[model samples]
Target chain A: MNYNFHWRPVMKALPELLEAALLTLQVAALSMVLGVLIGLGLSLIRMHMKGPVRWLATTWVELARNTPALFQLFFFGFGLGAVGVHLTPYLIVLIALTFNNAGYLAENFRGGFKAVPDTQIRASRSLGMTAFQAYTRIVIPQVLRIVYYPMTNQMVWAVLISSLGMLVGFRELSGETQFFASKTFRIFEYFAITAVIYYVIVKIILGAASLLSKRLFRY
Target chain B: METTSRFFSGFTPNDLWFLAEAAGRTLWISILSIGFGTVLGVFFGWALSVTKTAGTLTIAPILDIFRSVPLIIQLVLFFNFAPMIGLRLSPFDAGVIILTIYTAALVSNVARAGIEAVGMPMRRSARSLGMSYWQDMRYVVWPIGLRAVFPSWIGVALGVMKDSALVSVLGYVELLKASQILITRTQDTLLILAIAGAFYFALSYPISLYASKLEERWSQ
Candidate 1:
């Protein structure tokens, strides 16, 4: 109740914070792209492949899903370093987020794949479509539609989890906020602004996602 | 061997004891938060369902703020802000308060969906049978709604349990923080992390498996 509130320092740092926000978006978007690609591959392998490969994919999905994201980031940061595989903080966060995103996205893709009936694939094949064509044109699009909402959610999750970059010393939005807050000791003002930035970012993502869904899924 | 001795100390049995105690704290905090959160969430959810427009205007947006922001940021903000407002809260207290609210925000949605899943006709029938409103809720709505949302509730609970790890950021010595301390002491990064991951998986995997199985059985 006695502490004086300061907005001036926060205002001075706003541009840098916004710049860091872009970095946050960039890393999140990159991770989501890589995650979706790898997730799709892992789901397909789990569906079609056998033996060690499928087991490896299952292990990846389960580990990602079951453990906390921060733990995974720490593993990438220090655990790998222990084995002499050094990574920059940016790479650590990127790899960790990608690892988490791919795991969760793989499960969503699996469910999506299952939701597409076997008969549809068989019918496409019977109509003289090649296996590749049956999958590419007939199945994948439907699976994408089924998974579109979850993918959007995962994208938001990637953005939220990227905030953990602060702990590893990566200068994402939260990290930059932490940096300035420590210097100015305007901890509340700095984080309060960061939270608003996050809220706005989330709203924009949801808004764009809904609009995109309209375009992509319009029947 | 020489390099190993220089860089890595033996992970003593005491470290295992330390982790187990920290694991207990993790469970205790999660349980406390989830318990309080669920009660508050169920009330909020009931209110949201019962008073749609008013609830949407008031409660829903506030709850949405909790949902939209990252938990870590929320933790940092609340931890820093509390002392400024003359509330002398410990990290543990602040962590619990914030986590409880976060959990409630999530659970409120699940609870509302569960309530909605119990159709109007079902409740009407109970009322027609001369049951009082509270009686009808207790007898008809509660059981059916619980079953409908049980898996989702489990998902939220497990999610919160994992998310409670974020509380470590506030300097609460939970399982993850304990392992960090151990890693620093032993420099056995891989070993300690593996053990911590295993502890998490052990706690999480069985419950998730059971939830999925229940969901499948319920769907059938």
Candidate 2:
């Protein structure tokens, strides 16, 4: 227990860490947006479609869920590269996170959809609403409400999974920490602070989600 | 085509053995951590249920930190922090230690919910039947509570198994790390990744399917 603590280097690089934290949030938020859109489509297809199209969506969801997020990130990073489709590291993280998020969120959305009674859709349809209008105006809004908490959980997951970007050389928060830690050989100190930063980011997201939920679900 | 030809040696029997060993390590570590974590989690959960305010003030926040931070960061920090404090832990040991705590943190909540699912009235009834507190918990609560949270416990266990891949960051040669090494050596990235992913999917999918089926049955 005689090792000396070093906080100076970590403090000096706090600004860079903060910037990288923002990048982490950006990638997470962006992936969550894409994930929700794709997940909704996938859930619908799974619910109503047949043949290979539904199979494709099912495969996507299973593969994403059944594998490790790091493995998925590698698939996007190196697996695709094997077929000669090279992408930037940022795009790699973005695409991989989106794929993983969509998979999990699709399942949650499916559960949410199931919880909404079929009678409601029929009720809306008989109210002179078109099928699309019934879905958009009646079904989706309720489904979103039902799945709101899960979506918030997914967003938190998105942020956490984005940390895998470090392995693939994406210069997000964890990657930035790795970079500085390697240079300074202050592995413990650098990662210690990075962990704190991640904790604060997660807390903020949770707080904001709670506040947003109160507003959105106000009766 | 030239690069592909240069690196694409056919997959050998040795590589299969390598992957099998790696998969075994992955399963071994997961089983070890999950076993210890669940036991510890049940204890923590019982403590939390028994002493609500004290547990929330002390154990809850500590567990929250484990849940909040990414596993990779926790691994990295603990891996480095170990040597500084004069503990000479191997990568596997450190990975298992952190993962156990992480699993315990998650399982604690599930365990708590399970305990709570067995209502206070039921516990009181058990006590009135001349059961001691421990006997009441063992006979009345444990069976019922375990049933209530079995699916969630499975989810946490499966999650911890998948998350064990992150331990590869600490230089433990689990399944993911094994594939990476093979990819570097053979440069057959697609083949290696496909096999590795299949191994994971095979290990994970059946159990999850079974859990969901069990959940459906129980709900009915």
Candidate 3:
């Protein structure tokens, strides 16, 4: 009870901390873009392939989901180093986040694909559209609509998880906070502000998602 | 090529047993956290459904921040803050407590949504059948709500299982921590983490498959 709260040290370090927070968002945003592309590929692999071909994608997604994201991050980070392939922390995080994000979103997108009946694809194909055009013109747009909300949730997840970049020494917001907190011996204060920043970021994501969803899904 | 051979030959019975033991610790932590989380979550969900009281209002924002904040930060904060507040707990205990809180927050939302998904008509019908509020909930609201909640709960359970790995950062030598040690000594980081991930996959994949199977059955 005797420990006093110190705000001055944290306030003075605000600019650097803010910059780190932006870095967190930047990595998250970049990973999300990569993740979506990977996830789409995963869903397609799961949907179209048979036997072991489908199982390959299933195993990848299940491993990503079932194991800790930390392990995935370390697996690629340290695992690759063990094989003499070195990647920077940012690259490691980007790759790991994309891998993990694609796995989870693959499941969500798979579900979204199911909700859109198979007959539509068949109908598009029968109407002289090739398989590629059938998917492009008919199936994918509906799949996007179906998965939009879940994609928003994934965005929030992507941002929240970017904090793990700190563990790998990526110098994101939480990493910056830890550095200052350790330096000033203000573990509580530094993390407290960082927590607030994280909270605001999540709220903004949810708020912006709802706005976008409202417009995008107007019926 | 020699080191590659060494990596493959790096198998010892003792190392295998160590991995098994680490898997046990991971399962133990996950089981305890999920049990506590489900219990508290059900309570909060019930409370939320019953009324919009002050505590009900307070529960949500608290869950929001807890849910949004990364598990590592929470662990660091709680592990450090414990002694200062006169609560003495080992890292294992701290990890369990925080993981339980994190799981409970997510479960609470799932439970609340499940409860709400049960139509008002079912509750009203039960009430009109001479059932008290508790009787109505027990016989009608809960049964229907739980069905909807089951699949989502499975997802949360898998999440908590994997997330327990985060406790490694606090020096609790679960699967990931154990792998880190083995990696240092054996210098086989890829194989060790790959083995560790297989253990996790062994633990989680069956349940995920089961959930999906059940979802298909239930929807049918």
Candidate 4:
């Protein structure tokens, strides 16, 4: 394939890409927090609740895990607007990502919970620990340790999946790349630079998470 | 309450049919895209595993490029650029191509892990049994490696299913696009969105459940 290479437009658009990357970082960080909270809540419900709540938790986990993150975003971002509710574009994007992240996070956390020895719970109960106290003191920390490694993967996914936020007009990195690509018609250059940015960001985050895991879990 | 009523009232029979039709398209697109992705993925996976120099050092940087490039950007490039280069493609074709490449990158990594997980002894023994390198790979290595990696492969498939929705932005009448159309027409936000989510759940939940079951059975 014959191609014309140009750097001038890409150079000019670097600022936009940087702005987009910043938004991407913001979205990913916020969504990771939200997803972790939602995941913890779902996992706890699955562990301690009965009947419908457990079923719902499992169902949510399956549905989110099975479906594409893009689909969830589209369903929430555009579909929500279809039925008459107009949430802020970013919030809609965040909600969709939160759900998607929660599904996988819940599964990871559930596995961690499973890894918590039954005897520990028994011991805690015998010591007059309430169910809440038992979970917080005896179960959650251990589960976090078990789940930490996978949390790194999920966190990376959070960063990657944040690109879909662009689809709903969130103006994240990918969206900014597209904006530059369309503006200058330098598609490859725009995409190539942003792609590198993404890889670097992911690598840095994963490295940081791994270091943090070592410190926090010491394993 | 008024807002909720309006949202609930948005679904007409035509809208239901529209969604069903869209679901059919979504399924067709997903199947086709995943099929291409699976083959290309396995091939790239094999390439990454066997070709020591390319596999170890070079392929990863290239694969990193592919993985980090957003699917939407890739699709846009194919959608907008293909026609300019005398490679006219329908939106569906473009979508499939984009997904295939993206999913292939995923498959490559997962498949490489699977192959590596099979360990060195298996390869050595197969070679000692007078098997050619290609023969050993085809007969002994792939079957076991792929089976071991099936859970992860399914995870990639799940990811592909989700990413396929991005094709809707290119105006393919996939499930999400259909919902977008309904939303624009009816102006009901919550009910239609919830219904769309239910439809997505319908599409995805079974595959996930089956994958979970398969993971359990395989690991056992």
Q: Give the 10-residue window scoring lowest on summed lDDT in candidate 3 chain B.
A: B1-10
> Model 1 off-target regions past 4 Å?
B1-8
lDDT digits (tens) for residues B76-152 of candidate 2: 99998888778999999998999999999999999999999999999999999999999998999999998999999
DockQ of each: 0.86, 0.85, 0.75, 0.45
Q: How many angstroms is residue B147 displaced in model 3 relative to the true structure, after the best TM-score fit?
A: 1.0
Please give the TM-score that candidate 4 achieves against the real structure: 0.86
Find the 10 residues in a row with the least total lDDT in model 2 chain A. A1-10
lDDT of the candidates, in the order given: 0.95, 0.94, 0.88, 0.81
For residue A120, model 2's alpha carbon misses the true position, in angstroms, by: 1.1
Off by over 4 Å in 3: A126-128, B1-11, B53-56
- Rank the models by lDDT, top first: 1, 2, 3, 4
Q: How does model 1 score on DockQ?
A: 0.86
lDDT of 1 by residue, A58-85 (tens): 9999999999999999999999999999
**Chain A TM-score relative to the true structure, per candidate:** 0.99, 0.99, 0.95, 0.94
Q: Where does model 3 sit among the CAPRI classes? A: medium
Candidate 1, clashing residue pairs?
none
Q: Write candidate 4's Cα lDDT for B85-161 as tens digits.
A: 77878899899888888888888888888888887998999999999998988898888888888888887887787
TM-score of the second chain in candidate 4: 0.88
